[model samples]
Target: MAQKKARKAESSSQRGKAQKKKAAGQAARAATRSEEVSGIQAFIKYLKEVRVEFEKITWATKKETIGVTVAVLAITFFFAAYLGLVDFSLTKILGLLY
Candidate 1:
């Protein structure tokens, strides 16, 4: 049983190494293929890919955008008031010390 477990682990490790080498070879081939493409062709390919990726994006609706904007404004107002209060208190304390 112990030997079986050890053999299993060894085989899995070897398989992992083989997979890594296979992936590396595929990447090398892809790089060579890309290198063979003309510059303008590569640019057009890049633009096409960008457009495809943009098509996959899920944009926020107007309602969602307005809600986020309102939330941000409220948080900003609260923080500004809090910081102003702290600054006033510190200034009063320092004035008394002087």
Candidate 2:
């Protein structure tokens, strides 16, 4: 019957639309997966470069490191003592004035 044929045609068109939508969804998922892979690859490449640069560094010897630490400690103690003396002198002078 003509009505039966028309129904079949309508059903086929709907199936075609559904198939297209499914294919588009699959393509979008594929694109997103590829982007994630590329991002991971870029990060791995950056880490490799950082490792290579780290290997090229010239670290200080133990003696040099100790010398620098001692110098820093000496300077810190000197400044601390100087500041404490200044603060105590100022406090006493202010107390006398008050």
Candidate 3:
């Protein structure tokens, strides 16, 4: 009867120790999660600041946009024609040499 009582007490003490270790591990994990959450919050704050700065910028009007677009297209067409002429000249020169 005495031996049975001793075994029960020892088992109960071991169970208490196991519960304490589990609680400590859980506390450590919570701290790690909180650090991760703080990093995400900082990133969100940075994005919000960028958005505010963009709102302060001046955008072009419709007329200015169309004017610039037309100028770009004209320049692109001129360059394409110039390059095509150069390619044709080079091919003819190469054929004569060969």
Give the Cα lDDT of each candidate.
Answer: 0.98, 0.97, 0.97
* Tens-place lDDT digits, model 3, residues 1-98: 99999999999999999999999999999998877757788899899999999999999999999999999999999999999999999999999999
Clashing residue pairs found in predicted model 1? none
TM-score, structure 2 vs. true: 0.62
Worst 10 residues of 1 by lDDT: 33-42
Rate residue 7 of model 2 by lDDT: 100
- Candidate 1 residue-wise lDDT, 1-98, digit = tens: 99999999999999999999999999999999877978898899999999999999999999999999999999999999999999999999999999
**Using alpha carbons, what is the TM-score of model 1?**
0.65
Per-residue error for 28 in candidate 2, Å, reads 23
lDDT of 3 at 32: 88
Give the lDDT of residue 20 in candidate 2.
100
Q: Which candidate, 1 or 2, would have the higher TM-score against the true structure?
A: 1
With candidate 1 superimposed using the best TM-score fit, by how many Å does residue 64's alpha carbon deviate from the native?
Answer: 0.6
Report the lDDT of model 1 for residue 51.
100
lDDT of 2 by residue, 1-98 (tens): 99999999999999999999999999999998877757788899999999999999999999999999999999999999999999999999999999
In lDDT terms, how accurate is model 3? 0.97
